[model samples]
Target: MELRVEGLACRRGEAVVLRDVGFVLAPGEALILRGPNGAGKTTMLRALAGLTPPVAGTISAPQEAMAYGAHADGLKAQLTVAENLTFWAAAFGTSGIGPAVAAFDLGALLDRRTADLSAGQKRRASLARMVLTGRPIWLLDEPTVSLDAANVARFAAAVSTHLEAGGSALIATHIDLGLAETRVLDVTQFAARAAARREADPFAEAIE
Candidate 1:
Protein backbone atom coordinates (compact mmCIF):
# COMPACT_ATOMS: atom_id res chain seq x y z
CA MET A 1 0.00 0.00 0.00
CA GLU A 2 1.14 3.54 -0.62
CA LEU A 3 1.23 5.82 2.44
CA ARG A 4 0.52 9.46 1.73
CA VAL A 5 0.58 12.20 4.33
CA GLU A 6 0.01 15.92 3.79
CA GLY A 7 0.32 18.83 6.18
CA LEU A 8 0.25 16.28 8.98
CA ALA A 9 0.52 17.24 12.62
CA CYS A 10 0.93 15.30 15.88
CA ARG A 11 1.08 15.92 19.61
CA ARG A 12 2.37 14.28 22.75
CA GLY A 13 0.28 14.91 25.76
CA GLU A 14 -1.18 18.49 25.47
CA ALA A 15 1.73 19.94 23.53
CA VAL A 16 1.93 20.08 19.79
CA VAL A 17 5.14 18.43 18.71
CA LEU A 18 4.98 18.33 14.96
CA ARG A 19 3.02 20.18 12.31
CA ASP A 20 3.13 20.71 8.58
CA VAL A 21 4.75 17.33 8.26
CA GLY A 22 4.10 15.54 5.00
CA PHE A 23 5.60 12.67 3.07
CA VAL A 24 4.66 9.83 0.78
CA LEU A 25 5.84 6.26 1.17
CA ALA A 26 5.43 4.18 -1.91
CA PRO A 27 5.73 0.44 -2.18
CA GLY A 28 9.25 -0.89 -1.74
CA GLU A 29 10.52 2.28 -0.10
CA ALA A 30 11.64 3.21 3.41
CA LEU A 31 11.79 6.53 5.24
CA ILE A 32 14.17 7.12 8.15
CA LEU A 33 13.04 9.77 10.63
CA ARG A 34 15.80 11.65 12.44
CA GLY A 35 16.02 14.36 15.10
CA PRO A 36 17.15 14.87 18.67
CA ASN A 37 15.33 13.00 21.46
CA GLY A 38 11.74 14.23 22.03
CA ALA A 39 11.75 15.91 18.60
CA GLY A 40 8.49 14.16 17.63
CA LYS A 41 9.76 11.36 15.47
CA THR A 42 7.78 8.91 17.56
CA THR A 43 4.76 11.15 17.44
CA MET A 44 4.86 11.18 13.66
CA LEU A 45 5.02 7.41 13.58
CA ARG A 46 2.10 7.16 16.02
CA ALA A 47 -0.08 9.32 13.85
CA LEU A 48 0.93 7.38 10.81
CA ALA A 49 0.15 4.15 12.59
CA GLY A 50 -3.25 5.52 13.56
CA LEU A 51 -2.48 5.25 17.25
CA THR A 52 -2.52 9.00 17.64
CA PRO A 53 -5.19 10.68 15.57
CA PRO A 54 -3.64 13.43 13.51
CA VAL A 55 -4.14 16.92 14.82
CA ALA A 56 -4.25 18.28 11.27
CA GLY A 57 -3.95 17.45 7.60
CA THR A 58 -4.46 14.05 6.02
CA ILE A 59 -3.01 10.56 5.86
CA SER A 60 -4.09 8.17 3.16
CA ALA A 61 -3.43 4.46 3.43
CA PRO A 62 -5.45 1.29 3.44
CA GLN A 63 -7.22 0.31 6.61
CA GLU A 64 -5.01 -1.93 8.76
CA ALA A 65 -2.23 -1.75 6.20
CA MET A 66 0.38 -0.45 8.59
CA ALA A 67 2.05 -2.41 11.39
CA TYR A 68 3.50 -0.49 14.31
CA GLY A 69 6.43 -1.40 16.58
CA ALA A 70 7.48 0.65 19.54
CA HIS A 71 10.29 0.40 22.13
CA ALA A 72 8.14 -1.60 24.54
CA ASP A 73 8.64 -5.02 22.91
CA GLY A 74 4.98 -5.89 23.07
CA LEU A 75 4.66 -9.54 23.97
CA LYS A 76 2.90 -11.98 26.24
CA ALA A 77 5.49 -12.82 28.86
CA GLN A 78 3.84 -16.11 29.73
CA LEU A 79 3.59 -17.34 26.20
CA THR A 80 6.28 -19.24 24.38
CA VAL A 81 7.80 -17.58 21.35
CA ALA A 82 5.98 -19.85 18.99
CA GLU A 83 2.70 -19.24 20.75
CA ASN A 84 3.18 -15.52 20.52
CA LEU A 85 3.81 -15.65 16.81
CA THR A 86 0.80 -17.87 16.29
CA PHE A 87 -1.42 -15.46 18.20
CA TRP A 88 -0.34 -12.49 16.18
CA ALA A 89 -0.69 -14.37 12.95
CA ALA A 90 -4.23 -15.28 13.79
CA ALA A 91 -5.03 -11.77 14.86
CA PHE A 92 -3.89 -10.42 11.53
CA GLY A 93 -5.82 -13.09 9.64
CA THR A 94 -2.59 -14.60 8.49
CA SER A 95 -1.99 -18.34 8.93
CA GLY A 96 1.69 -18.92 9.07
CA ILE A 97 4.66 -18.18 11.31
CA GLY A 98 7.33 -19.92 9.26
CA PRO A 99 8.55 -16.84 7.47
CA ALA A 100 8.71 -14.80 10.64
CA VAL A 101 10.61 -17.44 12.54
CA ALA A 102 13.11 -17.83 9.74
CA ALA A 103 13.43 -14.12 9.26
CA PHE A 104 14.28 -13.55 12.92
CA ASP A 105 16.23 -16.77 13.47
CA LEU A 106 13.81 -17.78 16.17
CA GLY A 107 13.71 -21.48 15.45
CA ALA A 108 15.75 -22.35 18.48
CA LEU A 109 13.80 -20.15 20.82
CA LEU A 110 10.30 -21.01 19.70
CA ASP A 111 9.36 -23.10 22.68
CA ARG A 112 10.81 -20.78 25.28
CA ARG A 113 8.56 -18.43 27.21
CA THR A 114 8.98 -14.85 26.13
CA ALA A 115 9.83 -13.75 29.68
CA ASP A 116 12.87 -16.00 29.73
CA LEU A 117 14.31 -14.60 26.55
CA SER A 118 17.17 -12.17 26.47
CA ALA A 119 16.48 -8.56 25.61
CA GLY A 120 17.75 -9.01 22.08
CA GLN A 121 15.68 -12.16 21.72
CA LYS A 122 12.57 -10.36 22.89
CA ARG A 123 13.32 -7.48 20.54
CA ARG A 124 13.54 -9.87 17.63
CA ALA A 125 10.25 -11.44 18.65
CA SER A 126 8.66 -8.01 18.91
CA LEU A 127 9.76 -7.04 15.44
CA ALA A 128 8.73 -10.37 14.05
CA ARG A 129 5.19 -9.25 14.68
CA MET A 130 5.57 -7.13 11.60
CA VAL A 131 5.83 -10.23 9.51
CA LEU A 132 2.85 -11.82 11.18
CA THR A 133 0.80 -8.73 10.46
CA GLY A 134 1.28 -9.13 6.77
CA ARG A 135 0.81 -5.41 6.48
CA PRO A 136 2.46 -3.54 3.64
CA ILE A 137 3.61 -0.60 5.70
CA TRP A 138 5.74 -0.86 8.83
CA LEU A 139 6.13 1.98 11.32
CA LEU A 140 8.97 1.12 13.66
CA ASP A 141 10.28 3.26 16.50
CA GLU A 142 13.90 2.43 17.35
CA PRO A 143 13.55 -1.14 16.15
CA THR A 144 17.12 -2.06 16.80
CA VAL A 145 17.06 -0.92 20.43
CA SER A 146 18.21 -4.04 22.23
CA LEU A 147 19.90 -5.76 19.34
CA ASP A 148 23.58 -6.57 19.12
CA ALA A 149 25.61 -5.87 15.99
CA ALA A 150 24.77 -9.26 14.51
CA ASN A 151 21.05 -8.96 15.21
CA VAL A 152 21.10 -5.47 13.79
CA ALA A 153 22.51 -6.89 10.58
CA ARG A 154 19.85 -9.54 10.66
CA PHE A 155 17.14 -6.94 10.99
CA ALA A 156 18.63 -4.82 8.23
CA ALA A 157 18.66 -7.82 5.96
CA ALA A 158 15.06 -8.63 6.80
CA VAL A 159 14.01 -5.07 6.03
CA SER A 160 15.93 -5.17 2.77
CA THR A 161 14.09 -8.31 1.83
CA HIS A 162 10.78 -6.74 2.80
CA LEU A 163 11.43 -3.76 0.52
CA GLU A 164 12.50 -6.07 -2.28
CA ALA A 165 9.17 -7.76 -1.87
CA GLY A 166 7.36 -4.41 -2.19
CA GLY A 167 6.81 -3.46 1.43
CA SER A 168 7.30 0.05 2.85
CA ALA A 169 8.76 1.07 6.18
CA LEU A 170 9.02 4.24 8.26
CA ILE A 171 11.71 3.97 10.87
CA ALA A 172 13.19 6.21 13.56
CA THR A 173 16.73 5.35 14.44
CA HIS A 174 20.11 6.91 15.24
CA ILE A 175 22.24 4.29 13.47
CA ASP A 176 22.25 3.17 9.89
CA LEU A 177 20.40 -0.01 8.96
CA GLY A 178 22.24 -0.16 5.60
CA LEU A 179 19.10 -0.41 3.55
CA ALA A 180 19.10 0.64 -0.10
CA GLU A 181 15.50 1.83 -0.19
CA THR A 182 16.18 4.38 2.55
CA ARG A 183 15.35 8.09 2.60
CA VAL A 184 16.04 10.26 5.63
CA LEU A 185 13.64 12.90 6.94
CA ASP A 186 14.64 15.21 9.76
CA VAL A 187 11.68 16.05 12.02
CA THR A 188 13.35 19.10 13.55
CA GLN A 189 12.17 21.24 10.65
CA PHE A 190 8.57 20.50 11.51
CA ALA A 191 8.61 21.22 15.24
CA ALA A 192 5.46 23.10 16.10
CA ARG A 193 6.42 26.48 17.44
CA ALA A 194 4.44 28.49 19.96
CA ALA A 195 4.29 31.32 17.45
CA ALA A 196 2.91 29.03 14.77
CA ARG A 197 0.44 27.63 17.27
CA ARG A 198 -0.86 31.03 18.24
CA GLU A 199 -1.19 31.86 14.59
CA ALA A 200 -2.96 28.63 13.62
CA ASP A 201 -5.71 27.66 16.05
CA PRO A 202 -3.29 26.25 18.61
CA PHE A 203 -3.06 23.36 16.17
CA ALA A 204 -2.65 20.22 18.23
CA GLU A 205 -4.35 18.50 21.17
CA ALA A 206 -2.70 15.56 22.88
CA ILE A 207 -3.71 11.87 22.90
CA GLU A 208 -2.34 10.88 26.30
Candidate 2:
Protein backbone atom coordinates (compact mmCIF):
# COMPACT_ATOMS: atom_id res chain seq x y z
CA MET A 1 0.00 0.00 0.00
CA GLU A 2 1.10 3.56 -0.65
CA LEU A 3 0.02 6.79 1.00
CA ARG A 4 0.85 10.02 -0.78
CA VAL A 5 0.32 13.62 0.14
CA GLU A 6 0.93 16.58 -2.16
CA GLY A 7 1.08 20.19 -1.06
CA LEU A 8 -1.20 19.42 1.84
CA ALA A 9 -2.55 22.25 3.92
CA CYS A 10 -4.21 21.83 7.32
CA ARG A 11 -6.19 24.22 9.43
CA ARG A 12 -7.94 24.47 12.75
CA GLY A 13 -11.09 26.56 12.47
CA GLU A 14 -10.24 29.69 10.45
CA ALA A 15 -6.59 29.55 11.34
CA VAL A 16 -4.32 27.79 8.90
CA VAL A 17 -1.72 25.83 10.83
CA LEU A 18 0.32 24.20 8.10
CA ARG A 19 0.72 24.47 4.33
CA ASP A 20 2.64 23.09 1.40
CA VAL A 21 3.41 19.85 3.24
CA GLY A 22 3.87 16.68 1.26
CA PHE A 23 5.27 13.18 1.57
CA VAL A 24 4.86 9.60 0.46
CA LEU A 25 4.92 6.42 2.52
CA ALA A 26 5.21 2.94 1.16
CA PRO A 27 4.34 -0.28 2.92
CA GLY A 28 6.51 -1.18 5.94
CA GLU A 29 7.64 2.43 6.36
CA ALA A 30 7.15 4.89 9.18
CA LEU A 31 7.21 8.70 9.10
CA ILE A 32 7.72 10.73 12.24
CA LEU A 33 6.35 14.29 12.41
CA ARG A 34 8.45 16.64 14.53
CA GLY A 35 7.51 20.20 15.42
CA PRO A 36 6.82 22.63 18.25
CA ASN A 37 3.69 22.47 20.39
CA GLY A 38 1.55 24.52 18.01
CA ALA A 39 3.31 23.54 14.81
CA GLY A 40 0.25 21.63 13.58
CA LYS A 41 1.65 18.09 13.82
CA THR A 42 -1.69 16.89 15.17
CA THR A 43 -3.53 18.64 12.36
CA MET A 44 -1.34 16.92 9.79
CA LEU A 45 -1.98 13.51 11.31
CA ARG A 46 -5.72 14.23 11.56
CA ALA A 47 -5.88 15.21 7.91
CA LEU A 48 -3.91 12.13 6.89
CA ALA A 49 -6.23 9.87 8.87
CA GLY A 50 -9.38 11.54 7.48
CA LEU A 51 -10.44 12.53 10.98
CA THR A 52 -10.17 16.11 9.73
CA PRO A 53 -10.35 17.43 6.21
CA PRO A 54 -7.35 18.86 4.44
CA VAL A 55 -7.72 22.54 3.80
CA ALA A 56 -5.77 22.21 0.57
CA GLY A 57 -3.89 19.73 -1.65
CA THR A 58 -4.63 16.03 -1.92
CA ILE A 59 -3.89 12.78 -0.11
CA SER A 60 -4.08 9.56 -2.08
CA ALA A 61 -4.69 6.43 -0.07
CA PRO A 62 -7.34 3.93 0.91
CA GLN A 63 -9.08 5.81 3.70
CA GLU A 64 -10.77 2.66 4.91
CA ALA A 65 -7.40 1.10 5.71
CA MET A 66 -6.34 3.77 8.18
CA ALA A 67 -6.73 3.93 11.97
CA TYR A 68 -6.27 6.99 14.14
CA GLY A 69 -5.03 7.05 17.73
CA ALA A 70 -5.34 10.51 19.25
CA HIS A 71 -3.81 11.98 22.37
CA ALA A 72 -6.88 11.08 24.41
CA ASP A 73 -7.20 7.47 25.52
CA GLY A 74 -10.84 7.31 24.31
CA LEU A 75 -11.67 4.91 27.13
CA LYS A 76 -14.82 4.51 29.18
CA ALA A 77 -14.09 5.12 32.83
CA GLN A 78 -16.53 2.46 33.97
CA LEU A 79 -15.37 -0.27 31.62
CA THR A 80 -12.66 -2.77 32.41
CA VAL A 81 -9.44 -2.56 30.40
CA ALA A 82 -10.26 -5.73 28.51
CA GLU A 83 -13.82 -4.59 27.93
CA ASN A 84 -12.65 -1.35 26.37
CA LEU A 85 -10.17 -3.10 24.11
CA THR A 86 -12.74 -5.74 23.14
CA PHE A 87 -15.26 -3.07 22.25
CA TRP A 88 -12.72 -1.26 20.05
CA ALA A 89 -11.62 -4.48 18.40
CA ALA A 90 -15.20 -5.34 17.46
CA ALA A 91 -15.94 -1.83 16.31
CA PHE A 92 -12.96 -1.94 13.99
CA GLY A 93 -14.08 -5.32 12.55
CA THR A 94 -11.20 -7.20 14.19
CA SER A 95 -11.15 -9.92 16.83
CA GLY A 96 -8.95 -11.37 19.54
CA ILE A 97 -7.28 -8.68 21.67
CA GLY A 98 -4.52 -11.02 22.79
CA PRO A 99 -1.82 -9.42 20.66
CA ALA A 100 -2.60 -5.90 21.79
CA VAL A 101 -2.89 -7.01 25.41
CA ALA A 102 0.47 -8.72 25.31
CA ALA A 103 2.09 -5.94 23.29
CA PHE A 104 1.14 -3.23 25.78
CA ASP A 105 1.68 -5.34 28.86
CA LEU A 106 -1.99 -5.01 29.69
CA GLY A 107 -2.46 -8.53 31.13
CA ALA A 108 -2.43 -7.48 34.78
CA LEU A 109 -4.70 -4.51 34.15
CA LEU A 110 -7.12 -6.35 31.86
CA ASP A 111 -9.69 -7.01 34.57
CA ARG A 112 -9.31 -3.62 36.21
CA ARG A 113 -11.56 -0.67 35.45
CA THR A 114 -10.10 2.00 33.20
CA ALA A 115 -10.61 4.66 35.84
CA ASP A 116 -8.39 2.73 38.23
CA LEU A 117 -5.40 2.55 35.89
CA SER A 118 -2.65 5.08 36.22
CA ALA A 119 -2.02 7.73 33.58
CA GLY A 120 0.68 5.63 31.96
CA GLN A 121 -1.50 2.53 32.02
CA LYS A 122 -4.38 4.38 30.45
CA ARG A 123 -2.06 5.67 27.72
CA ARG A 124 -0.94 2.11 27.04
CA ALA A 125 -4.51 0.91 26.78
CA SER A 126 -5.32 3.73 24.38
CA LEU A 127 -2.36 2.88 22.16
CA ALA A 128 -3.23 -0.81 22.26
CA ARG A 129 -6.60 0.01 20.74
CA MET A 130 -4.83 1.17 17.60
CA VAL A 131 -3.28 -2.28 17.21
CA LEU A 132 -6.63 -3.93 17.86
CA THR A 133 -8.04 -2.22 14.78
CA GLY A 134 -5.76 -4.38 12.66
CA ARG A 135 -5.47 -1.61 10.11
CA PRO A 136 -2.39 -1.13 7.94
CA ILE A 137 -1.89 2.61 8.37
CA TRP A 138 -1.64 3.95 11.91
CA LEU A 139 -1.95 7.68 12.59
CA LEU A 140 -0.76 8.31 16.12
CA ASP A 141 -0.67 11.70 17.87
CA GLU A 142 1.61 12.04 20.89
CA PRO A 143 1.54 8.26 21.38
CA THR A 144 4.04 8.24 24.21
CA VAL A 145 2.41 10.90 26.38
CA SER A 146 2.67 9.27 29.78
CA LEU A 147 4.71 6.18 29.08
CA ASP A 148 7.93 5.41 30.93
CA ALA A 149 11.23 4.27 29.40
CA ALA A 150 10.35 0.57 29.50
CA ASN A 151 6.83 1.05 28.19
CA VAL A 152 8.18 3.28 25.46
CA ALA A 153 10.42 0.40 24.37
CA ARG A 154 7.38 -1.86 24.31
CA PHE A 155 5.49 0.59 22.11
CA ALA A 156 8.46 0.77 19.75
CA ALA A 157 8.51 -3.00 19.50
CA ALA A 158 4.83 -3.02 18.69
CA VAL A 159 5.36 -0.50 15.91
CA SER A 160 8.25 -2.53 14.57
CA THR A 161 6.02 -5.59 14.43
CA HIS A 162 3.38 -3.68 12.53
CA LEU A 163 5.90 -2.43 9.99
CA GLU A 164 7.40 -5.88 9.63
CA ALA A 165 3.92 -7.13 8.73
CA GLY A 166 3.76 -4.73 5.77
CA GLY A 167 1.97 -1.91 7.55
CA SER A 168 2.93 1.79 7.71
CA ALA A 169 2.62 4.54 10.30
CA LEU A 170 2.60 8.32 10.59
CA ILE A 171 3.39 9.22 14.17
CA ALA A 172 3.24 12.80 15.52
CA THR A 173 5.27 13.13 18.68
CA HIS A 174 7.91 15.37 20.31
CA ILE A 175 9.91 12.44 21.72
CA ASP A 176 11.92 9.76 19.96
CA LEU A 177 9.93 6.56 19.33
CA GLY A 178 13.10 4.50 18.66
CA LEU A 179 11.94 3.15 15.31
CA ALA A 180 14.78 2.34 12.91
CA GLU A 181 14.91 3.92 9.44
CA THR A 182 11.96 6.17 10.25
CA ARG A 183 12.07 9.45 8.34
CA VAL A 184 11.31 12.71 10.15
CA LEU A 185 9.25 15.56 8.78
CA ASP A 186 9.80 18.87 10.46
CA VAL A 187 6.55 20.89 10.41
CA THR A 188 8.12 24.05 11.77
CA GLN A 189 9.06 25.28 8.31
CA PHE A 190 5.48 25.43 7.10
CA ALA A 191 4.02 26.67 10.37
CA ALA A 192 6.72 29.27 10.86
CA ARG A 193 6.07 30.70 7.42
CA ALA A 194 2.35 30.89 8.21
CA ALA A 195 3.12 32.62 11.48
CA ALA A 196 5.45 35.04 9.77
CA ARG A 197 2.86 35.88 7.15
CA ARG A 198 0.27 36.52 9.80
CA GLU A 199 2.61 38.75 11.75
CA ALA A 200 3.56 40.69 8.64
CA ASP A 201 -0.06 41.43 7.93
CA PRO A 202 -1.60 42.65 11.16
CA PHE A 203 -5.11 42.44 9.66
CA ALA A 204 -4.70 38.95 8.18
CA GLU A 205 -6.63 37.39 11.01
CA ALA A 206 -9.39 39.96 10.76
CA ILE A 207 -9.63 39.52 7.01
CA GLU A 208 -9.90 35.77 7.35
Candidate 3:
Protein backbone atom coordinates (compact mmCIF):
# COMPACT_ATOMS: atom_id res chain seq x y z
CA MET A 1 0.00 0.00 0.00
CA GLU A 2 1.10 3.55 -0.70
CA LEU A 3 -0.24 7.03 0.13
CA ARG A 4 1.02 10.12 -1.60
CA VAL A 5 0.01 13.72 -1.20
CA GLU A 6 1.39 16.35 -3.53
CA GLY A 7 1.18 20.09 -2.95
CA LEU A 8 -1.91 19.64 -0.81
CA ALA A 9 -3.59 22.59 0.83
CA CYS A 10 -6.74 22.95 2.94
CA ARG A 11 -8.74 25.90 4.12
CA ARG A 12 -11.60 26.54 6.48
CA GLY A 13 -13.44 29.41 4.84
CA GLU A 14 -10.88 32.24 4.65
CA ALA A 15 -8.18 30.71 6.81
CA VAL A 16 -5.56 28.56 5.12
CA VAL A 17 -4.53 25.81 7.48
CA LEU A 18 -2.38 23.34 5.58
CA ARG A 19 -0.53 24.72 2.59
CA ASP A 20 1.59 22.97 -0.03
CA VAL A 21 2.02 19.85 2.11
CA GLY A 22 3.26 16.66 0.52
CA PHE A 23 4.58 13.25 1.58
CA VAL A 24 4.63 9.58 0.67
CA LEU A 25 4.32 6.40 2.74
CA ALA A 26 5.08 3.02 1.28
CA PRO A 27 3.83 -0.31 2.50
CA GLY A 28 5.01 -1.22 6.05
CA GLU A 29 6.06 2.40 6.62
CA ALA A 30 4.49 4.84 9.05
CA LEU A 31 4.61 8.61 9.27
CA ILE A 32 3.79 10.71 12.32
CA LEU A 33 2.32 14.18 11.82
CA ARG A 34 3.34 16.56 14.61
CA GLY A 35 2.09 20.06 15.20
CA PRO A 36 0.84 22.32 17.94
CA ASN A 37 -2.79 23.22 18.41
CA GLY A 38 -4.52 24.86 15.43
CA ALA A 39 -1.57 23.93 13.20
CA GLY A 40 -3.79 21.91 10.83
CA LYS A 41 -2.73 18.41 11.91
CA THR A 42 -6.30 17.18 12.11
CA THR A 43 -7.14 18.95 8.89
CA MET A 44 -4.36 17.14 7.06
CA LEU A 45 -5.47 13.79 8.44
CA ARG A 46 -9.06 14.45 7.44
CA ALA A 47 -7.92 15.41 3.98
CA LEU A 48 -5.91 12.22 3.68
CA ALA A 49 -8.88 10.21 4.88
CA GLY A 50 -11.13 11.86 2.32
CA LEU A 51 -13.37 13.14 5.11
CA THR A 52 -12.39 16.63 3.98
CA PRO A 53 -11.48 17.76 0.51
CA PRO A 54 -8.18 19.53 -0.14
CA VAL A 55 -8.45 23.00 -1.55
CA ALA A 56 -5.47 22.30 -3.83
CA GLY A 57 -3.27 19.38 -4.94
CA THR A 58 -3.95 15.67 -4.76
CA ILE A 59 -4.07 12.67 -2.40
CA SER A 60 -3.39 9.30 -3.90
CA ALA A 61 -4.32 6.21 -1.90
CA PRO A 62 -5.67 2.76 -2.32
CA GLN A 63 -9.37 2.08 -2.72
CA GLU A 64 -9.63 0.25 0.61
CA ALA A 65 -8.35 2.60 3.30
CA MET A 66 -9.70 3.48 6.75
CA ALA A 67 -9.40 6.45 9.04
CA TYR A 68 -9.96 6.97 12.77
CA GLY A 69 -10.38 10.48 14.08
CA ALA A 70 -9.51 12.00 17.47
CA HIS A 71 -12.90 10.91 18.70
CA ALA A 72 -13.58 7.22 19.21
CA ASP A 73 -15.86 7.04 16.22
CA GLY A 74 -17.13 3.49 16.54
CA LEU A 75 -18.27 3.44 20.15
CA LYS A 76 -21.99 3.90 20.39
CA ALA A 77 -22.79 5.45 23.74
CA GLN A 78 -26.10 3.62 23.89
CA LEU A 79 -24.81 0.22 22.78
CA THR A 80 -22.96 -2.55 24.56
CA VAL A 81 -19.32 -3.02 23.59
CA ALA A 82 -20.14 -6.24 21.79
CA GLU A 83 -22.99 -4.63 19.93
CA ASN A 84 -20.78 -1.76 18.92
CA LEU A 85 -18.20 -4.13 17.53
CA THR A 86 -20.88 -6.16 15.81
CA PHE A 87 -22.29 -3.07 14.17
CA TRP A 88 -18.87 -1.94 12.93
CA ALA A 89 -17.98 -5.40 11.65
CA ALA A 90 -21.12 -5.52 9.55
CA ALA A 91 -20.48 -2.00 8.34
CA PHE A 92 -16.97 -2.94 7.28
CA GLY A 93 -18.19 -6.06 5.48
CA THR A 94 -16.73 -8.47 7.97
CA SER A 95 -18.36 -11.64 9.21
CA GLY A 96 -16.95 -11.90 12.73
CA ILE A 97 -16.13 -9.59 15.61
CA GLY A 98 -14.33 -12.20 17.72
CA PRO A 99 -10.82 -11.39 16.50
CA ALA A 100 -11.15 -7.66 17.02
CA VAL A 101 -12.69 -8.15 20.47
CA ALA A 102 -9.87 -10.40 21.64
CA ALA A 103 -7.13 -8.39 20.00
CA PHE A 104 -8.07 -5.21 21.80
CA ASP A 105 -8.62 -6.96 25.17
CA LEU A 106 -12.28 -6.06 24.96
CA GLY A 107 -13.55 -9.48 25.98
CA ALA A 108 -14.60 -8.43 29.47
CA LEU A 109 -16.05 -5.19 28.26
CA LEU A 110 -18.04 -6.87 25.52
CA ASP A 111 -21.23 -7.10 27.55
CA ARG A 112 -20.72 -3.70 29.12
CA ARG A 113 -22.25 -0.57 27.66
CA THR A 114 -19.81 1.63 25.80
CA ALA A 115 -20.77 4.48 28.08
CA ASP A 116 -19.81 2.37 31.06
CA LEU A 117 -16.29 1.71 29.82
CA SER A 118 -13.46 3.96 30.86
CA ALA A 119 -11.76 6.30 28.43
CA GLY A 120 -8.94 3.90 27.62
CA GLN A 121 -11.34 1.01 27.10
CA LYS A 122 -13.39 3.14 24.74
CA ARG A 123 -10.29 4.04 22.75
CA ARG A 124 -9.34 0.40 22.44
CA ALA A 125 -12.82 -0.50 21.33
CA SER A 126 -12.65 2.19 18.69
CA LEU A 127 -9.33 0.78 17.49
CA ALA A 128 -10.92 -2.65 17.23
CA ARG A 129 -13.39 -1.25 14.78
CA MET A 130 -10.51 0.05 12.66
CA VAL A 131 -8.95 -3.38 12.71
CA LEU A 132 -12.18 -4.96 11.58
CA THR A 133 -12.09 -2.83 8.48
CA GLY A 134 -9.26 -5.04 7.20
CA ARG A 135 -7.99 -2.18 5.11
CA PRO A 136 -4.33 -1.92 4.17
CA ILE A 137 -3.88 1.74 5.03
CA TRP A 138 -4.84 3.47 8.29
CA LEU A 139 -5.11 7.18 8.98
CA LEU A 140 -5.18 7.67 12.75
CA ASP A 141 -5.60 10.95 14.56
CA GLU A 142 -4.50 10.85 18.19
CA PRO A 143 -4.83 7.09 18.44
CA THR A 144 -3.14 6.86 21.82
CA VAL A 145 -5.33 9.38 23.57
CA SER A 146 -6.70 8.17 26.94
CA LEU A 147 -4.58 5.00 26.86
CA ASP A 148 -2.36 4.07 29.79
CA ALA A 149 1.21 2.82 29.47
CA ALA A 150 0.19 -0.82 29.27
CA ASN A 151 -2.54 -0.19 26.76
CA VAL A 152 -0.21 2.07 24.84
CA ALA A 153 2.21 -0.79 24.58
CA ARG A 154 -0.58 -3.02 23.38
CA PHE A 155 -1.50 -0.46 20.77
CA ALA A 156 2.10 -0.24 19.62
CA ALA A 157 2.27 -4.00 19.29
CA ALA A 158 -0.92 -4.03 17.28
CA VAL A 159 0.47 -1.40 14.93
CA SER A 160 3.72 -3.32 14.55
CA THR A 161 1.84 -6.44 13.61
CA HIS A 162 -0.20 -4.52 11.13
CA LEU A 163 2.91 -3.15 9.43
CA GLU A 164 4.49 -6.56 9.35
CA ALA A 165 1.42 -7.76 7.50
CA GLY A 166 1.99 -5.15 4.75
CA GLY A 167 -0.24 -2.47 6.26
CA SER A 168 0.64 1.23 6.41
CA ALA A 169 -0.29 4.07 8.77
CA LEU A 170 -0.23 7.84 8.93
CA ILE A 171 -0.70 8.90 12.56
CA ALA A 172 -1.27 12.47 13.74
CA THR A 173 -0.44 12.68 17.41
CA HIS A 174 1.07 14.88 20.10
CA ILE A 175 2.12 11.85 22.15
CA ASP A 176 4.80 9.31 21.42
CA LEU A 177 3.25 6.08 20.08
CA GLY A 178 6.44 3.91 19.93
CA LEU A 179 5.98 2.98 16.30
CA ALA A 180 9.21 1.73 14.69
CA GLU A 181 11.03 3.88 12.15
CA THR A 182 8.25 6.42 12.01
CA ARG A 183 8.90 9.58 10.03
CA VAL A 184 7.84 12.91 11.47
CA LEU A 185 6.46 15.93 9.60
CA ASP A 186 5.98 19.26 11.29
CA VAL A 187 3.05 21.15 9.80
CA THR A 188 4.74 24.39 10.75
CA GLN A 189 6.85 23.84 7.65
CA PHE A 190 3.78 24.66 5.64
CA ALA A 191 3.93 28.22 6.89
CA ALA A 192 7.46 28.52 5.58
CA ARG A 193 6.39 27.17 2.23
CA ALA A 194 3.57 29.67 2.04
CA ALA A 195 5.89 32.53 2.92
CA ALA A 196 8.31 31.53 0.20
CA ARG A 197 5.49 31.38 -2.32
CA ARG A 198 4.37 34.85 -1.31
CA GLU A 199 7.92 36.19 -1.63
CA ALA A 200 8.06 34.85 -5.19
CA ASP A 201 4.65 36.23 -6.13
CA PRO A 202 5.02 39.08 -8.69
CA PHE A 203 1.89 40.89 -7.42
CA ALA A 204 3.04 40.73 -3.79
CA GLU A 205 6.54 41.96 -4.75
CA ALA A 206 5.05 44.87 -6.70
CA ILE A 207 2.78 45.82 -3.77
CA GLU A 208 5.73 45.74 -1.37
Q: Indicate which candidate wins on TM-score.
A: 1
lDDT per residue for candidate 2 within 1-208, as digits (tens), equals 8899988888887888888887898899999988878888888888888878888888888688898989889999999999999999899878799999999999999999999999999999999998988889999998898999999999999999999999999998878887876999898867846656866896887887
User: Global CA lDDT of candidate 2, please?
Assistant: 0.89
Which candidate model has the greater TM-score, 1 or 3? Answer: 1
lDDT of 2 at 8: 88
Ranking by lDDT: 1, 2, 3
Best by lDDT: 1
User: Model 3 over residues 38-65: C-alpha lDDT tens digits?
Assistant: 7888887777777777789887874457
In the predicted model 3, the residue pairs found to clash are none
Candidate 2 global Cα RMSD? 4.8
TM-score attained by model 1: 0.92
Better of 1 and 2 by lDDT: 1
Query: Total clashing residue pairs per candidate?
Result: 0, 0, 0
Q: Local error of candidate 2 at 80, Å? A: 0.2
Residue 117 lDDT in candidate 2? 92
